[model samples]
Target: MDKHELAAFLRNRRDRLQPEDVGLTSGPRRRTAGLRREEVAVLAHISTEYYVRLEQGRAPRPSAEVLAGIVGALRLTDAEADHVHLLAGTPLNHTGWHRRDVRPSVLALLERLPQTAGFVMSAAFEVLAWNDLAVALMEDFAARDPEARNLARRAFLTDSPEEGPLYGISDVTEFRQNVVRELRSAVARYPSDPAMTNLIDDLRDGSAEFARLWERNDVQPARMLTKTFRHPIVREITLNCDELHIDDGDQHLVLYSAAKGSPAAESLAFLDALGTESLNSRRR
Candidate 1:
């Protein structure tokens, strides 16, 4: 690792951004031109002392995960991310591997589950693919900007809808924490991917809630269980959330199903018809 280059890069990135750019409020009386070292350390989930050491070129070689965190914290672009990886001596070619595709079998499974709300997501919570029912119950992924299709991005970075449909559950705190924890895992797995790093940077800069949750440094296995949603058309429905991990692609097939003959099941059927109509109208 090029210690001098790494230190210079870290300092330069840190000096370019302001607090507001990262969802932090600038104090009434500010002395520094950019973000404080402590702020960067908090965003990167590292100690201020260690970050100081890094900036001074006195620290030991950082692990891939640490490099990833710093990359995200600094809002490094794709090229910059690669440069940081090289400086850390853990370079991995991330070109063309940034986004994973949904398998044909997974698409077939989604097609077969007409009454269920299902979608495929990447480790970074990017919506790779989704069924019509998912659109009916939540915002239309196809209609959103490609970058805006991420669950974590929308949940924390943007304002929650006032009275629209709920995605997983009505308990906002639990949902946000879960998303944050899962994203932490994704950062570790795809440290060299610019897209992942960019997403993290955006989240850290745009959402104080995300920054706070991320600072907890919690890691947990994503759990699949029952969840409640307040759908605008269906009112309220409770469903079982099943997450099938695609080990090869590191993606997840998330399906929500209600018990047969239950009220939620009936609501889901109604939603299917509504979703079909919505799809047909769009084609017109």
Candidate 2:
């Protein structure tokens, strides 16, 4: 079990709750931000000393029944509770390195999409496979080393001194926040995978913003419906964003498309014709 991570998760959850949230009176003398640990132990029907030990990262792995009680006491969301379970090493058949290979069918589908920029992303945000349009619309992932294709690294760590945003996308803040949340989940699901662990360590050490967000312990990222990319050739191209989950591999097929006969559609078609060449020239 990841004692440190489990302890931190529990503390973070506890700090977000008010006493009244669990039907307790906010006594005038109470100075705690959220419900007190003693209060949580009482609600969970566990001894305060034991709960304190858990928070101190000194306790043994909690039983499933005890974890259920703590989950209720902390008022954790479904996602957060699942995360707690993962950190506590509760077996959910979720351990392993995240899948990187794109399915053959998914690869074929990328080639079949007309005027759509489609790509497959692994759980850790590596662009595993892409159509020509995706390369044009985004960057040419084929040219970069496999390690450099990680969107998390691109989002957080910039080689440029000026530190420009990725792809000049309009929602940099939202995108970075989502990246942190997804990586948090990824690390929990594959705690022992060096790829995931090293990536998390690198980002936390390299980027202060990433470190701050990581401490928040946020699991649910807001869903984005549309994305606007500021391409040098097209100026501005907005597309409807659709993320299809490939459950078997825990991968995502992301498609960027524009409405039929619209200006964005025309721009996409133009990019499709220009292909990866235009983007390469711009990079040069």
Q: TM-scores of the models, in the given order?
A: 0.62, 0.66
**TM-score (C-alpha) between model 1 and the true structure:** 0.62
For model 1, name the residue pairs that clash. 22-205
Model 2 ranges with Cα > 4 A deviation: 1-93, 159-163
Top candidate (TM-score): 2
lDDT of 1 by residue, 63-115 (tens): 76677667667666667878888887875544323344556788888888858
Window of ten residues with lowest summed lDDT in model 1: 91-100
Indicate the worst ten consecutive residues by lDDT in candidate 2.
Answer: 92-101
lDDT of 2 by residue, 1-284 (tens): 99999999999999998886676899899976998999999877789999999999999998766776677678665577689889998753335456664567889999999999999998888888999999888887888887789889999997694435788789999999999998888888877556788999999999999999999999998898999998778888889999999976688999999999999999999988886886688767
User: Any idea how many clashes model 1 has?
Assistant: 1
How many pairs collide in each candidate, listed in order?
Answer: 1, 0
